[model samples]
Target: MTQDYGFALARERGIALGPIGHRIVEENELTRVWEVRLAPGEELGFHIHYHPYYVVSLGGGDNEIETIFGKTIATQEPLGHTVYIDEKRAIHKLTNRSDQTYLSRLIEFKAVRWTYDDDPAQARPEAGEQTPEGYAAAFREILEHTADLPWEPKSLKGLYQKMLWRDEETGASIALIKFDKGVGIPNAHAHASNQFMYCLSGKYRYIPTGTTLVAGSFYCNPVGSVHGPTIADEATIFLEIYDGPHYPVQPPWYTDPKDAT
Candidate 1:
């Protein structure tokens, strides 16, 4: 399915073929998820990534990349290997050289130095009339190895997080959350903005809705909508995202705003 990931603004800026995927499967204020599939001997033509992007390889195979600068690089990654690329304004073409097809999901972080910042209409639409978070003086960057990122404690018991990226100015963030078995939010609550989640392993459930998320599941909770009283049915790890402030006011669970992050 063809979808716009700030493509309209890219075109307005004289960029014509900047898309990095065969199809964009999902997009919103926080991220654009692209599904890339390259059959043996096939190629994805020269494309540019305008924002920081991470890729999770599913069907890994022999692949080669040729940059606009004429550099050719060969690569092979095992299935489930993940990498984050903080390219310095790069452009390249990729080809699958192996007999087997290559498949992967590439997620472009829309909140990180987004291409449409000058136009508020194209920025986080859900941010709406609320104040956008302010930019911090410095934010950590993980160039290519996301597996090496360290996990930090959360104010909530039995929960931990690894912050992948964040837009300090917009309160937009992407994080990997791990919930220990038998632990979760103690009560129903709401978020200040939209929340997006993708389960990577194990299981969890929202008690009120009887909605459960397991490996490969995706969930979204819109702004101001109350839900939760959640529990981790098993030790769970999931990707969590937010498009704006986490809460209208700091929740009682967290005494330190730093821990809340």
Candidate 2:
């Protein structure tokens, strides 16, 4: 947590493994995060990255990862579900396991060379409120927003994102997102920080599990979880937030489908 750019044992292995659609969204000298999207029926050919990743399912669709022997590995669904993949010899490919089409979004968190703990201490209960006091504000708003319109993911139509608030001084970010009905974001990829999201609209069929993440649900995608391209019956809206300045750029690796193995 010192925030220094000193080298660590992790730096010895440069670049990462993954397919073409994979790309970085945020990066700095110290840490970096990549965002990858996969459409329904699309596959992120087998690859690997030398970092821990947190996969955040934005909307509809199932996420499936398989090993070289065609054995099942990791799977996930939206409504805030997450999965972790280490950047060691974790070789696998991602696909939308659902019959429905959707967009999958992933944020990969890569730390700098040095290791440090940033763990937050456990919270104690407060006396009065039914729910935690800090979360009460969001809980109350959820009731107000549920009855609102156009909630579902579509290929086209409705607003995509709305920034709710931000604390530049503290590096805290928050926003509201609406995915069109019957559509998804994209495939599994990596990024640099822990991500949190909550659903506040129509239900979305989660990837990998084919479950539904509707209003009043929240999820967290830690460090590195190669998540999915989500999907939904109609437009679904949710809150998207993350801790960033994720990680720095990495050297390119091979991504050809034929040569991925």
Candidate 3:
């Protein structure tokens, strides 16, 4: 697909570089480009994202990153000095191991529901506008103001800037999610949109399908594919990218039957 409005804006306003620097390579309907930088002794610990990402180090020293599941999975410095991991399809962390700063570039594609999979009768052109509870409600307005939260609780899951980015205004949404140690979301459900999942840290036992995923693995669930109750030990995070405005499936538990259905 041609790079259009989304890609252009990513280049114009997306984080290209920082104490670590960054730049957007391209942004289109399916993918976006990004550049990253890290200062000496800097470490970007374990985090998550929804879209699968391809990354390459542009310059600098090595960094450290670790994922804590039942065990700790650490990345040696400069592992992707030239190679990039499809993060949307996998989960891991980035850190600067060397005394000097490091730099990396990535072009990631947000997951989207395919045209053929959705039920034609129910898939209205404006379906995205209808909010699904499990998806969007999880972070409502929280994404914009959230800063680095303490890790002690271990029960909480959150997203970081390097992994997932969301812009409600432009119809772009990405989720690098974490299933905190021993925690799982509610029962299985499907969304109106297609979804992509990647393992960044730890392991997961997804209910219904019984799929176990580790770091570097990716999973795609077509729209309406019922799967969830994601459970993990040690915080597990992953990226999910999709077309906007994603609505969540109203669970049966809602007080109002109308809301549930």
Candidate 4:
């Protein structure tokens, strides 16, 4: 008897190609993030995304996507807009329709776990059950704009955030953060989970690494790794994607905004 594979079989027949105007900015056990920039007429060649993912527009504009089935989707996205693709099945290609360069960030989840066995009962539990609560559903956001979300102050000075999603079970969260120019934390800190930062705009320096990150830069601070005292040279905007609750060691100069006199 021949085994039947659904989209997986079809995807095998689709064209396989490298990303267009995109580069692997960061990759780890949980995610692969891509930094993409397409000039007018440039395109991402035919490809299929097997995993759930999110696309965050840095400089939104018009674009056209053509699927293997010949369906075309025309989209006009705005800056800071985010779109989630849930378990995508189609093989597609993207074309930049506008004259200006199109910039965006693509984050793909690497959460699926499978076990091979002849008996169905031996199979592992559903993906959601084995992982931390909400981790399985984190990629389901259809579309959202960070500017429309409310900001919450962190323990650090000049830092504020707008949370995009938080996994209750794992305590992991995705958020948009803003740092006021010339403001910073005075002491280094570490978190319980790995932290990934993608700079959307402005400038800042991570003191320990001595790395000055700017727009389009990506950094991953592994769990237990001590890092900045981040100082903002300009009003900086960035995204923080982390695994597990953000339990950062309190810095010496940290002051809760709520306690301000």
Name the candidate that leads on lDDT: 1
Clash count, candidate 1:
1
> What is each predicted model's overall lDDT from 0 to 1?
0.74, 0.52, 0.50, 0.68
Residue-level lDDT of model 1, residues 8-73, one tens digit each, is: 444465645546898876665557778899999998976766578877776767899976556789
Q: With candidate 1 superimposed using the best TM-score fit, by how many Å does residue 148's alpha carbon deviate from the native?
A: 1.5
Ranking by lDDT: 1, 4, 2, 3
**Compared with the true structure, what per-residue lDDT tens digits does model 3 show for residues 1-261?**
431212233235442322212566445555665657678766554334444465554456545554322233444435234444542311235666677667655655444322211223223246658654444322233243223543222222331223345544434456556555777656777765545566777788887678888888766554476788767856677766543334465564343432221
How much is the lDDT of residue 194 in candidate 3? Answer: 41
RMSD to native, candidate 1: 13.1
Clashes of 3: 35
Q: For each predicted model, how many residue pairs clash, with residues at least 3 apart or on different chains?
A: 1, 58, 35, 0
Output the worst ten-in-a-row residue range by lDDT, candidate 2: 112-121
C-alpha lDDT (0 to 100) for residue 191 of candidate 2: 45
Q: Please identify which of the two predictions, 1 or 4, would achieve the higher lDDT against the true structure.
A: 1
**Number of clashes in model 2?**
58
Measured with C-alpha atoms, the lDDT of residue 246 in candidate 3 is 40
What ranges in model 2 sit over 4 Å off?
1-17, 86-89, 102-105, 112-261
lDDT of 2 by residue, 1-261 (tens): 333221222233442335523676555332344555667777777654434555555554566776544567546576455566553433456787766543444444333121222111213335863755444322222223433543432223443555454434334455667866886644554445566777888877657667577887776665576565567777787787766522223312323221111
Q: Model 4 residue 17 lDDT?
A: 43
